[model samples]
Target: MQDKQLNKDEIAQLTEADWKQRLTSDEYHVMREKGTERPFTGVYNDIDDKGVYRCKGCGASLFNSDNKFDAGCGWPSFDQGVDNAAIDEHVDDSLGMRRTEVTCSNCGAHLGHVFPDGPRETTGMRYCINSVSIDLDKNEH
Candidate 1:
């Protein structure tokens, strides 16, 4: 089933309590608290189906199945987002390292981090995302 997308205005109105109520414990931890799921433990880590991945927090379209690739990184790796505006990237300086953190643009929910190492033949970018942060809508066609 396709989920309804929320606009920025709608997302802005959501309180932390609302998010806590809407998301599961894992989803709340990953998406709202900026936590990472254990490597290889995510539902989408080994998924090879055709679909669009949406933000679990707000149902905003984030990654297309065509952009997903197995990076052997124990996560759902994508070369790019569904579009430039589909994700918001920020510089993360925690864990004594610097990395680009990717988030849901509409809801400002943490998704994961992006790395420079990816398939050279493609965009050469790897968006390592947490499965709890997103929901996949399998395409019928």
Candidate 2:
């Protein structure tokens, strides 16, 4: 298990082979290649556990269970990240559609996309993250 997040310098020093060796095929596809898992097929989709979601690539704290909600969009949905620095958003124009892509700030791993169609009572933003991009660190509260 990863105990610490990688710094920018460390992240920059990693090679493609280093990433492939660190992650499984699926994780590499989704995180390194900017691929997306099938909707409703993600392990974290239905899980409602109390924990922190850390970046699978660098173990950077990304999301809290407190910000999680059932967006019914198939992936694990969070209203917000753990902090502003934990996630970085970029303009994704792939798939012929304009969308905002979210990545782990610590390692530049592709997490998923964020949309505006979230619960209005909260942040009104849906962080549709891929299950393979994160690992849950369950904590008892």
Candidate 3:
């Protein structure tokens, strides 16, 4: 990948079939195609399961269940990440709106978005992530 953005057609043609072959159906849809999965349908939504969540695309450690929080917005929300450098934030202005998009810093797999409207006690931010974008490490904590 280059520092310059790849056009959709360019991105769509960049060995996507290779990625499809490498990823599960759901993961291919979300990560390679930017498809959003329905909220509350994810395994992590109400999970008490112990683990570290990693980027499905590249196995990069992202979040722990300990950092998971119920944002009441139907998505598995977290006020924090496994670490400050665990992910990267990008500017997204699609759909006539502006938002900050988040992704795994290691692999650039889209996790979801971050918002300023968060609990004031900590970072005051919410990283609303897609369950399909992550793979649980299962009790690494």
Candidate 4:
């Protein structure tokens, strides 16, 4: 099922406490605190199912199953988001490394990092996402 995207007003109205209550501890850590789940430990790491992955924090559609691919990176990798508007990217200088951080466009929740070393056949971008940061809605068709 496709989720309704939340407006900025709705996203801004949600306090930290509300977010804490809405998301699990792990989800909160990864999505709200910009934490990364251990490699190979994420639920979606090896999933090849057909679905749309949405932000766990706000349920915003972020990635389509068609874009997902196994990069052997121990995380759920995708070539791109559902669209350009579904995610926001920023320069991350944390952990002594520079990376492009991907976030939910609606709520500014961290999703993961994107790398340039992806399949050359596709967009050449690898969206290395944390499983706790997203929920997948399996396509029934």
Candidate 5:
């Protein structure tokens, strides 16, 4: 894993070839091609480890494990991202449905989608993320 966080400037300079070289087939599919992963198959789906989930494409911190929750939606869900700047949401009108697509702000890598149906006590937002688009940086403390 990259110990240093990648900045947006560095990410912007990366091309498709660089992305392909940096990410695996599965990662490139989800993070680069904006494809979804099979539900309940992501490595982080059931994990409750404490740490930050960094973008697989740019090593930028996107989600904190403390915000993660089991939405039972097959993918790893989070109430929110690390902060407002960590992720960017866009309108996705694919599959004849209107949804909010989430992407890493640093690298513009597709992480997943956001839904209004989540824990009501919290943000009431479920950030359904693809595991292949992230890497867990477990907290040592």
Candidate 6:
């Protein structure tokens, strides 16, 4: 979590070797390769910690624990995000399945998918996210 993406000028100034030194293996894979971690397999999958979940790639606040829900799916699911601007939704037809892919708006890093099957009283939106793609900020108060 200590390692954050710098501005364009800062990152642009760094060589390939420098970038490698600044990032962890997982961060490099998810951020640079746009790959996904296995479902129900992330460290935060079972986390009961209280905090805001931010995009690991850009440190943008994405979700709050209060909004998280049990989707019975392998990944972490949320009924709501911090705000509309915190995430972006795109139409994804990859893998022959039509779905909306959600990404971190701040850095355009893929977090996971969105489904219309959410609580009826809620937004009817399910943000299925990858745990490794996020970093939690525990509240001290």
RMSD of each: 1.4, 1.3, 6.4, 1.9, 1.2, 2.7
Write model 2 residue lDDT over 46-129, tens digit each, in one string: 999998999999988999999999988899999999999999999999989999999998899999999999889999999999
Model 2 TM-score, 2 decimals: 0.95
TM-score of each: 0.95, 0.95, 0.84, 0.93, 0.96, 0.82
Residue 28 displacement (Å), model 5: 0.4
**Per-residue C-alpha lDDT of model 3 across residues 2-109, encoded as one tens digit per residue:** 223234454446486767776789888888666778988987777777888887776667888877878887778888899989999989897799999898776567
Which regions in candidate 6 have their CA more than 4 angstroms from the true location? 2-22
lDDT, candidate 5, 9-123, per-residue tens:
8877888998889889999999888899999999999999999999888888888898999989899999999999999999999999999999988889999999999889999
By lDDT, rank the candidates, best first: 2, 5, 1, 4, 3, 6
In what order do the candidates fall by TM-score, top score first? 5, 1, 2, 4, 3, 6
Q: Write the per-residue lDDT of candidate 1 for residues 84-123, one digit (tens) a residue.
A: 9999999999999999999989889999999999989999
lDDT preference between candidates 3 and 5, better one: 5
lDDT score of residue 68 within candidate 6: 83
TM-score of predicted model 3? 0.84
**Candidate 5 runs further than 4 Å off:** none
The count of residue-pair clashes in candidate 1 stands at: 0
Clashing pairs in 3: 51-139
At residue 7, give the lDDT of candidate 5.
79
Please list all clashing residue pairs in model 1, or write none if there are none: none
Native-vs-model 1 lDDT?
0.90
